[model samples]
Target: MEEKKFDINTLIGFVLMGAIMFWWIYSTQPTPEEIEAEKNKTEQVKEDTTVTNPTTSEIILQAGDSVTLAKAQTELGSFAYSTTLPSAKDSETILENDLLKLVISNKGGQIKEALIKKYVTYDSLPLYMIKDNNASFNINFGTTDNRTLNTKDLFFEPSLTKKGETQILSMKLKVSNNQFLEYQYEIKPNEYMVDFNIRSQGLSNVFNSSQQINLDWNLEGFRHEKSIRYENQQTELYYEKDDENIDYLSIGGEDDAEENDVNWIAYKQHFFSSILISEQAFDNIKLKSKTLVEDEEVDTTFTKAFYLKAPLALQGGELNYNMNWYIGPNDYQILKKYDRNIKEITNLGWGIFGFINRAVFIPVFNFLKGFIGNYGIIIILLTIVVRIIMSPLVYKSYLSSAKMKVLKPEMDEIAKKYPKKEDAMKRQQETMALQSKAGVSPLSGCIPALIQAPVFFALFRFFPSNIDLRQKGFLWADDLSAYDSVFKLPFKIPFYGDHISLFPILASIAIFFYMKMTQSQQMNMQQPTQEGMPDMQKMMKMMMYLSPIMMLVFFNMYASGLSLYYFVSNLLTITIMLVIKNFILDEDKIHAKIQENKKKPKKESKFRQRLNDAMKQAQEQQAQQQKRKK
Candidate 1:
């Protein structure tokens, strides 16, 4: 048996990984006091919302007091007359078309439930954009009678009407029929967008001259995907600045930003979203996204909690604002149709990589999707197309590697001639001279590989963000957008997760062999590097194993579609490598060509002359230092 090599870097890596695992496990476990607090935690979502409202304890106390009209009037002030409205006893009115179902609540004149009729959750339950009665959209302002009020605390009368193919619902918090605050909603057939308008009808005197009217919208995004951690990483708060670029909150932790000239705010989920758009620009916006989980299984009900405090751009003394609400999937095709830059919210990538995905990958993928029923087959075909396009680059990189391999014997001879550490600079100078004479640039191999990186990254962004892959089945994977667990472990394996996914395992295996083949090409030259440099061979060997292990652990809970792409990509790479090595490359011919080129008159460029001069100066300095020490 071969003795294992002792590597300090590998040892340190293991120690750090062990420390991280212990820290993660320790940090995620709830304390005894936290368990009790979670038991008593209010279902009303008071903890996440920053809006000034009666707490759960305060509400309970009021309910226990047997409050009367006098007590209500004192608390509600001029808006107290709304308690006796026509729809005071009514709970909800439905405004829906074929694509969407929205329930407008009589209590707050806000959307109580919004469900997408075409889709369902991972477990085949009705897909709700807003449910559990936990979402709140309240307008906060002061009344003329020196009383502050919130729309959620008042009841509104609801009226549902239909015009042509459009359904409309108007909820009015009537001081009377002549003076009221109205929330009008219009839903058109076969549309996911809802036209919403909040305008007070004739309330100039009943309202005070308050410039501090604020709109507080809070939502706890429901978990629809199977992997909470995977889904939460995708879920975040995104906003577009008016006449500016799109920006988003950090996904890994709590994020807060004060934005100006806001065009819209999207409480984006993994696949679904609830976006609020202002027809006019909004100024002075306070947006926040609080990550609801430190561990995947700890908080599974929701992905992230969102809070927004935006001052309404009031026209007159009353609220008069036109807006549209988008409560649907984060589909690229659908979102791109909107004039606003809502398409950016779907994470394709950024800069040139994003351009590559949109300009090249999306069109090709969608074209393949047009006739192909099997997504797995489509992915395989896509990989083949990508490999064919990148074949020239592959050939060039392989040719460069072969040239270096041909030069290995000479490199080993040079290493033997200068065996002492003191001759390191001379060895490097000779190596450069030899490479220059043979016309083999060291950077030739690196440039092609670097150019190919964007395509891989573009596809990495393409897979998970591709909504077409959701719930699509292939082989053992029932949902291509989620993990394909082949076997379930009895207990968690720290960083490796609780289940074994076959696609990622296959992908990791392919990566290991692919790296091994590449490393074999590089391991030919037994040459020592500069005196103070790190051991490149040991580092490369360490990476050859570490990379696959990392891939296995990371993609364990990631989207199966991404894993499938990587698996097919690596398999194609291995096949291409084999074809190039066995049939195309002629080692004997390459060696002959190198010898002929080296025999031809060598031209030393300015860069080479400067480098040789610098090395000679360094050698002289080293000699002087050695003599002084002696």
Candidate 2:
């Protein structure tokens, strides 16, 4: 989830108009004497209205209360006609395309439920984007007759009509047949985004002049993945504010923030999201989120809760807005087409790491996936391609390490000569001189290794966020986006999780071997250790073991796709290193080249000359200080 720091805008094309006028339709509350007389007149008329089920949208009349006409007219004022327009029974209207199905309730004129047709939950149930009381959308405003009204608390009359390929559902809270607050939804076939336009007609004078209109949207995300904690770690609130800049709140925490000019709001639940988008700016927006699951919880029903509230415009006495509801998978390509920067919600990473995924790995992998059926084979091929691209750097690094290996005996002799504690600076100066004469700089090897870091980090961000891998099976893993458990444990391990994942175990073993193969070469290339400095060789050896243990523990719950990538990547690295060391590089030739280079006059770089001058100045200062102390 990416966040931008600024106020939020109302959804695209939201233009609020003043409430329309209906003067003769509304009447003031009846007096106590008139109410008593009305009750007396209704004593003989038996109250027979019974509700089998009541939704949140209904203001149900009690058994003892009068269902008389005049009482309702007094209470509803201008909206009294709503009682006659529709029965308060719980009725649902459905709008569906090839990919999505939405069940809208007439009670609140809100989408009561949604199902992504192409997908299902982890347990194989239908994947409902909104269900039961888990989600709601409501508008709040005040009426002129000293009364406040919430759309969710009133009954809306529903009408479904078609415009060629588009299906439009109009839910109206009416003052009359032609005058009401309208919640209009227009959905075209085969699209995940639905165009929603909210506007009222004819009742411009009924709404209170001093009141502000607001929209309250809330959702409780369902458990879609096998692991609650893992999915929850990825689930978060994302929005766009201050135009194109993006930021995100830390996951697994509760926060309340207000932003100005926010363009969109995305309630992300890992693989899928429910996003609200607008073209114009909405001000004074409040965003809130809270985690639902606990670390040691038993319930796994839902993952998190989210809330968004922002004021709406009332222009020309009518509430009007044009917006879109995007309820679908967090697939990068599908979202990129919206041009809302909606693709920012897909967690591909940020900056150059994101650029690499977008420019290199993603496009290449997508091209390969078009023809390939098995993801495991695709991963293997992907790893091989990346390794091949990086092979030149691998060769240069190994060649440098080999040259350093040939010079190790002389380097060790220098270490023995500069054994005294105070001679550390002198040791560094002599070592640089020898390496310069040999035409080698230690940083030359490190530069290639450094250049490859972005690719690794990019892949690390790519696999888990890649929805294409969500249900894709690879070798022993049933779902590549989740850990592959070969065995279940009766007892839980703290960081290692409750089950034994085969891919992480294999990945750990692979990295252990790769490190063992190359750490010694890195160890040989280390400069002479100064007094009080930690031993670089010992640290490297410790890391050789420590890295695998960390991988074994850390990746136990990470996506199997990532573990597979690391495993294949390490195996390829080991193979490349072996091929380079034994078949490609020759230490005898490297030594001859180093000896030949030594006979030529060395030209010190400007930076090196400054370093030599600084070392001489430091040594002279130390001698003078020592004489003064004596």
Candidate 3:
């Protein structure tokens, strides 16, 4: 059998195919070495982390103990029906003996129209309920939309303990024979947390059994009338959860047609989850669904806990629930100690990729933040550090682009010599040959740039979040948590909203200059493509105009800190590119290198030979079929 000769075109096709394969593999596949290292690291992490449990104790106050309801406003009833309403505004209440510190304000004085001040949930403005599973419980009476719910009418009482710690004053209320029987509050302190328990005396259990005592932490004047959406927000981290339990008991609420009604909004720095407790059992519960609100792209989980079988019931004798509340920074070190994975609330985003983000990106950010006090500075330092790490790849990419730049003249000549569409194929072959002779891959520069895209995007998502940056101001910016707009407009622009940010404008300008410098190198080459050269040029010009414009508009209302990071990174990249072009690349030496490659031994690749054979066989079959038809 005669040996098959490979066409240059065929070899180029194989090369393109190989490049696509390599890119696909590179994007998706972790190298075996990386995989092995990851596995070892995972094992080490597991070995290092020890499980710890967080527990809280409850205290029961005796009736004889004279408790000062320091912040008590009023107690209403005629011996039979009595209830204490907290004072709306008496600074700090000091409960002494039997006298209540009542800060009476006409604003909040009714029990039916009271407001819930401090019942903890996952969200800031959460819903209140008469009964846990009652469908009416879905109506959110949170303080919003010009509605004011006075804390006085909302809370029973507020008091400071003997230790000076703030505590809530509440009476054990019982309803019997169409009468409301109320008892005063008592406080006792213990190590770790303060707990207040009130007991009712002379009141018998109704229905000769357990009567579920439903307390009202009502939002008197609050109403939900609108929904909201966000272009960008904090990312939440998610964990693999078994969502088999029923968390949604009764999803009732008037659908606010306005897009502004938030199904759920991402709180400042916490995860929002809905837990469904049954009227029967309210204590023992299990995590149910890990969900994200519709159209909300958060980084972490929106989990719901379902009381295994309805809420734990309270026996008529008495019902007691010890709530553990955390009211400080969500430090992972402390959160992880609880073992509840409450630390996961620091929104990392979801799925396997989310795990990688939480396990990798977050830790890296935290580590870097330790040294770099300022977050903006940390971003800059991180960018420089990443560039340094990827320097070897960057050097190779620059060398390849430089080689292509040097061959522009010769490549232009080949294009001019072959104007016909058929000869256009032949011209491309010569260009490839020229590129190969120059010891450069046309695609080499592109791959490294592509590799950096993920890191860039990951950081973009990371910084807007990373609560450590919240309220931390760098320069002219006030709060890094929100956008640092130099000026606010009275009107809103579509998609962009109403604000003017300087950082994105500076960034876009840097990008423009960077693109301009890159394309300028190709300007000396006179040859153009066979078709649509004018259109390509037009597209390039359009990109130059469009990209910066879009950035200026989109980032005008985004966090200035994020925009600053991109701006600094772009400026740095431009400087690096300039350095490579000016100092590292020599056009004369590159041309000489190309000439040297032309004299080396050239061998036909087996893949190239196979491709040519396939193409030839296809041509032969097509010719035979045409002849038969004729």
Whose lDDT is greatest here? Answer: 1
* lDDT of model number 2: 0.84
After superposition on all CA atoms, how large is the RMSD of candidate 1? 22.7
Model 2: per-residue lDDT, tens digit, 73-176? 56567776676644454688999899989998877789999999999887789999899889989988888897777888777888899999899999898888
Candidate order, TM-score descending: 2, 1, 3
lDDT of 2 at 142: 84
- The per-residue C-alpha lDDT of model 3 at residue 482 equals 53
Winner on TM-score (2 vs 3): 2
| Best by the TM-score measure | 2
lDDT of 1 at 598: 96
Candidate 1 ranges with C-alpha deviation above 4 Å: 1-75, 524-527, 602-630
User: What C-alpha lDDT does candidate 1 achieve relative to the native structure?
Assistant: 0.85
C-alpha RMSD in Å of predicted model 3 compared with the true structure:
34.3
For 417-486, candidate 3 gives per-residue lDDT tens digits of: 8877545446656666666555666667678777776666666666654556655677887656456667
Please identify which of the two predictions, 2 or 3, would achieve the higher lDDT against the true structure.
Answer: 2
